[model samples]
Target: MKKEKEIKPPIITDIQAIFDRARQAAIRSVDFERVMMYWQIGRRIIEEEQGGEQRAIYGERLIPYISEQLMPTLGSIFSTRNLIYIRQFYRTFPIANALRSQLSWTHYRSLSAISSIEKREFYLSETIKNNWTARQMERQINSHLFERLLSSTDKETLLSVARNEKQPADPKDIVKDPMILEFLGLKPESSYYEKDLETALITHLQEFMLELGNGYSFVARQKRIHLDGDDFFIDLVFYNRLLQCFVIVELKTHKLTHQDIGQLQMYVNYYDRIEKLPHEMPTVGILLCLEKNDTVVKFSLPENANIFASKYQLYLPTADQLQSELQKELSKQNVQ
Candidate 1:
């Protein structure tokens, strides 16, 4: 008969980790129950305030009466203002099952402050998508992150460009859009070339990635490949962590044609087949050109293709110009 060895307890880190998770789950359960209770209370109060027939009852005045009834026994959670917010929460989310379990009562309270249904939904979606804390969500709302991110070529990113200009880097820079380089050195004007544009983009790569979207990072420039004794080069390559895909960007000085689209599709196929891992999504290609023909693009690619052809501009338009263009675009859309 052999004596069994004693089994020791888990380490402190493991114990603490388990404890933390349990504590978080308990908090979440409590918070969810609290929110449900408030919503139900608000609903009942509203029902009581509204008379059974067309005649009115206490209406909004029942708020104070309910608060008075609950304050002594239920505590200060039943204040007039808080009751109003709770009622709004129920009305805003009529479907009881739609409440987000991950969010706490505080998150819902913060979201309830938003007036526009569309804007509120956008924030709610973004907040959950980003897994932001209440403070982070509030900060984003205050920063107008939605508006800033939606705006084309927002100026916030230029701060880095301004800093980079006062101090030159190790590498020699290329002059794109003669206008930009001229602004930098008063150099002689030259034709705007795609190569120059690509070179300039590298210097402002951070800004370019930001404009592209959240989670996009620069991967490579002039990414090269060899296939069947022929070599091909991609202008710009980016990886979006959120989208889990490689984004291939091509710069074209001329209007986009079916041939260019076919070329992009070929590159996308190359990436999807070779560069993408089993867990990664398929590659995406974007053709940024001076002009794009919608018909050519529609006819060139398969319906399921991820390649996109869009117009690009070297210069930033003024606010008024952008507004007027937006209005015209909206009008055209309405007409269509």
Candidate 2:
């Protein structure tokens, strides 16, 4: 018998990409349907309980009763805890048209827990603008990212940036101080070399970029620049599309000094003069140290210099700790 002709798969460019895009679209569609279903369920529950009045008659028992009845069929997702979240999801966003299709149910659940409307709105707008995943959104909330931004940036400007009404004009608006490096899996008590810390940051570069705020793309590590006979290497180099500038980051494991500031300033000047294109903005330098003296930082750079010194922490700060820090910052600003 003649051997059967072997069939081959057709050559298709980006076949994997095609499959990934299709799967993602399917997931998004299903998630959107689930969101709408939950919203409608919540609306029905509210309408039945209220019975055309502003206040509900059933009180707390209504949700439990509904959950107890529906959970067996709908599974654990309709549990009392989740039903409450679903109810809040509807209440939080009363207008169906106001709901963003981009956000998943998980995103809404986390967002509903926020009581402050301004804070909620800020996160909502930012999540959509940044395309943050549910986990990233939760991490930002846990880290008090909103409060951190508020501490450094004007409230109106921050909100305007979130709303896409204005771009960040200054590095302080995006570059986080006391940068959180918890994702690096480093010990807070142990000492680390500058190279070690740089390695950790490079390993967790995605999380690092997220912590860096927005529009940052990694350029190089240990970026070498030759000056006359001397050679200097920057720990990390990044470009911020929003700021339209090269960002030079120097890692200092010890407390920052005037000399460290001068080194970074020189790097910034080199980039501005030689590396930076005419159309690009001036290079900005940041000194990341275990500790920074604001007074030292102030005196080290000129008033108009594009240089800053910020502290880094291995762990995420508690809300109380962040609040205290913000209060201290505000007090200093008021005094100034």
Candidate 3:
């Protein structure tokens, strides 16, 4: 008899990819179930506490007693602190139907910690739209991203865009000034070259893009442009899908200068005239420097120029620091 043909399994990672995806979906389902369970627990706790009264009866001790009772069977997840969080979660989002299954318990916990309704809603919408992890949401909240954006754009427009009601109309709607790059691992006091900064940004490109806000994708780095026998290399190039434009970023390890602005402007002009498609919007230039003289930037560029100078911080600013800076900017705008 002829020898039976031998069969070998296919060599490909697609099977691994499928398994990874299934695992992710399963994890997400389990997380959502945990969220729902916590919500139900919160509701039940609230009902028992209220007992038809405006305030909970012995509210101070009730959580501890319940935690002591549940800990034996339910594990430490029902500890007093967590039980309090669970209770607050329901109060924050009273309507069970309003809870998004896409958000896990951790996400809801971070969101419920927010005191402002509008801020919470903005973060919720953005988390779902951007598919941000719980850690990312926490970072945004910690960085006062909502307040920072509000300083640049109107409240209604900012919220509407986050909610997908409308697209961002201007770069200011998305781009953040004083971008917190604490993730770059660069010390503010240490001296570094522009090339060093650029390399660091490239290394942490994912985090950098998140700092850039929405609708951006990396295009090129050190993009060479030849004009009239002169060769110019742009530091970094990105495309913003929402703005339909090329974003040219020029890194300055020192304070910005008028010449730096001029250089970025030339790059923006070149991209607009030479590389931009007919359907594309005008190119935008961003000067990411350690410091900027807003007065100089104002005078250097044309009134309608799609150019902006933004300061970059090696460390995250405190809430008070951000608020103070925002107030100063608002004051300048008001004066202008």
Candidate 4:
């Protein structure tokens, strides 16, 4: 009998891979060069309109005229607002070398909204170094992450804290108490089914994930697990890259109890044993409940337990409430 002929796999040469990479690099270089040219042109236009004087009247009118003239030639990219942004961009980052190549023009536009030069520079450096996407950048800014960190630590310490490779050293660093879920649309006193809550959370999943903390990416919602002929469904599961562990979140609309903690612990144990990589950290369990007994939580879990319980809010907490709670916590810590 004749043997079947073997099919050969297509060859991928190293030279071809190098050439492809070179082409991509060249495209990016050209695009960035164009952006830089536009920025410089905007700067020059602003300068000339000022008649080499900072207080010239033409400064106010020049952008509109230039935009009108250039719109047809430059297409939609040369809108008045975009041209103004380019001018602002040049003013914000005077040195081309200071501009981050990794960030797109849109990223620079967002950074330009920040008024403080030092704060803007810090955000720009962190965003570039951390490879934060535009959405992440916005979330960080909206959360007032820089100010929050600064309030708690010095600048050098804050940078170290922000860039630390380890999981958060303190509970305050990782947990956002009274998480905002305004998208749920259900009042705190209103009755809602588990499905309704889950649906709402899914609808506002991005905001939820941001509130959850850094490194958390959604894995599944209402994820079902079966073992020993029994069925168990976890409300939510997220993988935290920084912690290198599975973060299991259980949602409860009522007050938390010891049983709820136990159930979450079991789920965390399951993930730690079965799903976690060999080098990964222990799985963390968070119970997002309407109410939590701090005393019960302190006693229920081992001193070093990775499990946590945080309260959630339907709307943003009043500023006074947050301040009062923070002051209380600080007082207690100081006493301790």
Candidate 5:
């Protein structure tokens, strides 16, 4: 007698793979091409209603009546709020060819909230090209990315700046002086030790990583290192995917000193000699301190040093202070 064949159990990984592919395909489908479609629809609706006249009552009573009727047939999809959004979307993005497919409806909705047309356009273009999810888009917007780029570079250089896919070539590019750590909920004037700051950073690691810039992956905290029967603990360790290197960060709650820099260098050397992969770049060390002397830092490292020192603030710096500093930098660049 032939034996009955045994059935294999379904694998969760395989099921998840299928689900992910289906989800991606659905997102890519034009079943509801989001804001772009709505904008076009609204534009067409307006044009037909106008019949080539500029003085048509497009917004007054007509839009409300049409929206009311459309809502019943369209369900919640065509509510008055969405209809208004469609109209505003068209108004915001008058150039049809300029609309990007990668941006979801939510992205467009957020973009529409920005008052400045130039700022909105910058975000729209960058978000689409970068394939940024709605949350990423929102974060960038909140970070004032467009304004920051504009302050740093000219309009012609903006696209290149936005398209940067890796860690900045210069330390200045990645470094945000007085790096904000308000998310950690620590007060600047509060009596805090290095361990306290490190703990806070660990607690808010996700936000810290984003604020740190692209490609930073948490490796270990209070990472232990042994050498010649001695034990040492590095404050935090991370790997930057874009930089392709191990990054060792040493935290200091007070003014940075040559000692801090030297310790960081030792950590960097250790990682380079042992932890770093052969294919990866040399390990980079960052001295995150409350204060730094630029002159001392320049002299402490080699001519083209991979090691860097940056100041970290427990609270958010005033917008005015940041703006003024940016303005000064822009002016100097202009002069050069």
Candidate 6:
């Protein structure tokens, strides 16, 4: 028999990719120049207002006068309200060398609404790390993700991770206690089967991945496995790049049980033993239920197991509510 020649795949040029990169570069350059221009305007306005020899002459009417003179020349962007924003930009970021070029002016505009310096820094760092769009950044900030994450961790780890100084070592380090899914259009009282819920998640996979957090990509849904004439299916599957592991997700519309944990553990075991590469870490299983018993969670899994039981909520909670609930949980953990 003649030896067969190996067929190689064709190399395709992604002209769209090149175009997108060029587009992104152009947008970034324009955004950077716009930001610096505002910064310079603010600087000149402030310096001329305060440092001029006639310092006390126009203390009150200076801003209005500047707006009147600059608006006709600069267009609607230099309105008094935006000039205030520009002044705030200069005040917040005094050093030109330290401007975050990855972020667009829209992102900075939303971030400027944040009053706390520490929280602003955290959001800024995460925006850069996650490459979140302005809308996504605003949504995260509005969702109080920082507070929710801090609820699960101590302040130091929160700052360290936010600053990109440390990576999350455990799933719990990044997992929110009750993942929110208001975007899925499911109501808390809505009666839906597990398949229906999973379908909703798949339909809104992009938003689902966002809710999952940084570096999560969908792998499969209802993944099938067969062994000894038995057919098994996992509801949802994802790979977490940051964790370098397969994250098996099992969704339940009702309250969780030890049996659910056992089932998920079996799936995790199958992945670790058969599916995961030798270089990859053990598979991590997430049992996402509508409700769960903390005591049951503690008793069901081994202390060192990578599996976790987390609850899911249909609606977004108020910042105050999440903060208070997180504080109580932290206090309870400390007591334990």
| Best candidate (score: lDDT) | 3
What lDDT tens digits, residue by residue, belong to model 4 across residues 191-215? 8876788888889888778767677
Count of clashing residue pairs in every prediction: 0, 0, 0, 0, 0, 0
Q: Number of clashes in model 3?
A: 0
Model 4 spans > 4 angstroms off? 1-68, 84-108, 114-139, 142-144, 147-161, 164-193, 227-230, 273-279, 313-336
> Where does candidate 1 stray beyond 4 Å?
1-190, 322-336
Instruction: Provide the lDDT at 199 for model 6.
Output: 90
| lDDT by residue for model 1 (275-309), tens | 99999877878888777888888888888678887
lDDT of 3 by residue, 1-336 (tens): 999987655544677788899999999999989999999999999888877453443466789888888899989998989999999999998898888988999999999998867679979988998888898788677655776565544556655565467878977666667788898999878989999999999999988987887789999999999989999999999999998999999999888999999999999999999999999999999999999999999999889899999898887656676567667766978999
Assess every candidate by TM-score. Answer: 0.45, 0.62, 0.61, 0.59, 0.63, 0.62
**List of clashing residue pairs for candidate 1:** none
Kindly list the per-residue Cα lDDT of model 5 for residues 98-198, writing each as its tens digit.
Answer: 76767777887788788766567768877877888888888787655665454444434433444665435654455445566778898766798888889
Report the lDDT tens digits of candidate 2 across residue range 1-336: 999987656645468679989999899888888888888888887787777453343776788888888899979878989888988888888788888888899998899899867679878888998888888788777656676565554666655565457888987766667787888998978877988999999998888887776789999999988878998898999999998999988999999999999999989988999899999988888898999899989988889778988888787656676567667766979999
Better of 1 and 3 by TM-score: 3
Candidate 4 clash pair list: none
**lDDT, residue 86, model 6:** 81
Candidate 2: regions farther than 4 A off: 1-33, 36-106, 109-144, 147-153, 319-336
Sorted on lDDT, best first, the list reads 3, 2, 6, 4, 5, 1
RMSD of each: 15.9, 10.8, 10.7, 8.4, 9.1, 10.1
Segments of candidate 6 deviating more than 4 angstroms: 1-104, 112-144, 319-336
Instruction: Assess candidate 6 and give its lDDT.
Output: 0.82
In candidate 5, which residue ranges exceed 4 Å CA deviation?
1-33, 36-103, 112-121, 128-136, 142-144, 150-161, 165-178, 314-336
For model 2 the TM-score comes to: 0.62
Query: Per-residue lDDT for 36 in model 6?
Result: 85
Model 2 clash count equals: 0
Candidates' C-alpha lDDT: 0.69, 0.83, 0.86, 0.76, 0.75, 0.82
lDDT of 5 at 12: 72
